[model samples]
Target: MRAIAYFKQNDIHFSSDLPEPRIGADDEVLIDVSWCGVCGTDLHEYLDGPIFMPKDGETNPLSGKQLPQPLGHEFSGVVAEVGPKVTKVKVGDHVVVEASLGCLDTHRWPKTRLSCTQDKPCGACRKGFTNCCEHNGFTGLGVVGGAFAEKVVAGERHCIKVSPDLPLDVAALVEPLSVSWHALRSAGFQKGMTACILGAGPIGLTTIAALKGAGAKKIVVSELAQIRRDFAQSIGAEVFDPTAHGTNAAEVLKKMSGDDDGFDFAFDCSGVKATFDMGLAFTTFHGVCVNVAIWGHKPVDYYPMLVTCKEKILTGSIGYTTLDFESVVNALQNGDIPLDDCKKLISGKYTLEDGWEKGFMQLMHHKDKCIKILLTPNNHGELKSAK
Candidate 1:
C-alpha cells in the first residue's frame, strides 16, 4: 500500500511499501480508496504540526496510536471487503466515510438512525450529538489508517453508501460538505432566512451550497480573495470583497439586506479573529453566529459587549454527525445541490506520489487558486481543471 505518513512536524512522506490494512473486527469494512480530499487540517499538520498527529513518545488516548500515521480523512471509495457482521454495505458498493471516531463504550453506532443500547452515554452523544462526543478522535488524523493509501479499514457504522452514479471524485467531498451542513443545523437554519458566510475557502464555499440547499432567502459571502469571491458568485451567492470594504464589511452586509436587522445567521469559517468579529457584528439581534472553523491554539480577542448588546447566540460546531453525511449524499443524488457547480470545488487531483508537491504545496502557496485537491492512490495524472 502506498501512503503519505506524518513522522514529525513539517514532515510528510510518500511510502510505496506501507503495509496494507486488514479488517480486524466484525464491524469493520475495508475500502479500496478512489479519491481522498486534502484538508486544511492536513495542511496545518504539515506546516506546523503534531497538532492532531500525536507527539513523539506519546499515544492518542482514544486510538492508542502515535506518529507516522496516514494523512487523509475526506475520502470516498468502493467497498473491497467487509467483515461478516457488516450489513450496511457490500463489496463493490460506492461509499463515503464518516471519519469521526467517538468513544466506543459510550457512543452509539449508526448515528443517522441513532440506535443505542448503552446504559449510560456521553453527555454529547446522549443528545444525538456524537460529533462532539467527550472522547472524539478522527480516524485519518491518528485513530486509524486513512484513505491516503490504496486500502483503508474503517468501522461499518462510519461508512455511508452513495449513488453509484455520483462521480467518485465528487463523492470525496461528502465529509467536508457534512461539516458545513452540521454548522447550518447547529445555527437552527430555516428557509426564508438570510445568512452570511465569512470566508470563501472550501468550508465557506460548501457553507454557501448548504445554505442554498436549505433555501436561505439571501446569502452573502465575504471574502478577500477575488478568485474565491467569483467562485461564490458562480454558485449564486452575493459576494463582498472584504479588502475593498475594509472594516465596514458588516455595515455593507446590513445595507445589502435592505434593513439594519442584519443576517438571521452568520458563519465564521475563516478561523481568524477579524472574521470572527465580523461574523458576530453581521448577525442580527437574537440571531445566531456559528463558528465552523477550527482555530487550533490561536486565541481570539473580541468585545464582550458585542454579544451582550445584541443578545446574540454565540456557538461553535465541530465535526458532523452521520445524519449530516447522509443529508449531503441525498442532496447530491436528488439534485437539490447543483452537481456541476459543486464539481467546481475540486480544483486539483494528484496521485499519492505527487501529493506532497503538486497537492499540499499547491494549496499551501496558491490557495487562492486551489479549492479541494483530491489525491488518488491509483490516478497519477494531470490536474483536473475547475468547471
Candidate 2:
C-alpha cells in the first residue's frame, strides 16, 4: 500500500510499500480511494503543524490506531472489502466515508439514544442541533484511518452510500459540503433570508451555494480578491470587495444594494478577526451571526455589546453530524447543488507525488484565488507513503 503520511509537524514525505490496513473488527469495511478533496484544515496542518493528529501511546481507546497516521477526511471511494459482520454494504458499493468516528460501541444501542439525541443531548446531538459529538470519537484523524491513501478502513456506520448517479469525484465533496450544511443548520437559517458571508473562499462559496439552494432571497459575499469575488458571482452570489469599500460593510452594502437595509443573517467564514467585525457590522438588528471559520484563539471580542444591543444571535458552528452529512448527499443527488457548477469550484488539482508542501502550501498562500484542490494518487490509485 502507498500513502502520504505526516512524518513530523509540517513535513509530509512520500513513500511506497506501506503495509496495507486490514479489517480490524467485524463492523469495519475497507474502501479503495477514488478521489480525496483537499481542505483548509489539511492545509492548516501542513502549515501550522499537527495539533489534532494522534501521538504515540495515545491510542483512541476506541479504534486504537496510533500516531503519525495518514491525513485525509473528505473523500469518496468504492468498497473493496467488508468485515464478517458488515451487512449493510458489500464489495463494489460506492460510498463516501464520514470524517467522524464516535464511540459507537457505547452509543449504538437504543438506550444511548437519549444521550445521542436532543433534550438530554449535552449541546450537540439534539435533533435539529448537534455540532461536534463531545462524547463521540472522531473518525479519520482519531479512531479510524482516513481516505487519503489507496485504502481506508472504517466502521460501517461512517460510510454513506451515494447513488450510482453521483460520480466519485463529485461525491468527494459530500463531507465538505456537509460541513457547510452543519453550519447553516446550527445558525437556524430560514428561507427568504438575506445573508452576508465574510469570505468567498471554497467554504464561503459553498455556504453561499447552500443558502441559495435553500431559497435564500439574497446573498452578499465579502471578498478581498477579485478572483474570489468573481467566483462568488459565477455561483450566483452578490459579491462586495470589502477592502476597496472602505472597511465599513454598511457603506459597502449601500454601494452594492443601493438603499437596502442590513442583511438578515451574517456568516464569518474567513476565520479572521477583521472579517468577524465586518460580519457584526453588516448584519440586521436581531439577525444571527454564525461563525463557521475555525479560529484557533479565544474568539471573544467587543461584539457581545453589539449582539446584546440588537438582541442578535451569536453562535459558533463546528463539524458536521450524521444528519447533516445525509442532507449534503441528498442535496447533491437531487441536483440542488449543481454538479456542473460544483465542478467549477475545483480550481486546482494536484498529485500526491508532488508532496504535501508543494500542493498544500499552494493552498495556504493562494487561498483567495484557489477554490478546492483534489489530491489524487500519482497513478490515480493509492496515495504513496512518506519517505
TM-scores of the models, in the order given: 0.91, 0.86
Q: How would you encode candidate 2's per-residue C-alpha lDDT over 1-387 as one tens digit per residue? A: 667775566666666765677886688888988878777777666676565665545655544556556778888888999989998788999898777654334332333322333234545444333345565555445455565678888778778888877877778888878878888887888887788888887888889768866778888888888988998999888888776756565666744533255777878888787877777777777778898887777755664788898788888888887688788888888877788777777665566666365456667776665677777763454343211
The backbone clash count of each candidate, in order, is 0, 12
Residue 161: error of model 1 in Å? Answer: 0.5
Looking at model 2, residue 58 earns an lDDT score of 65
Give the Cα lDDT of each candidate. 0.84, 0.71
Worst 10 residues of 1 by lDDT: 105-114
- The candidate that achieves the highest lDDT relative to the unseen native structure: 1
- The sequence of per-residue lDDT tens digits that candidate 1 reaches over residues 1-387 is 799988777779899887888887788899999999999889988887877777887776665656777889999999999998999999999999999976552222322122322455567877878888877778789667788889998888889999889999989999998999999987799999998899999999999888887888999898888888999998899989877776676788777755588888889988888888888877889889899887767788888898989899999888998899999999889887778877888888888898888888888998888889999997723457433
All candidates: CA RMSD (Å) = 3.9, 4.7
Error of 2 at 340 (Å): 1.6
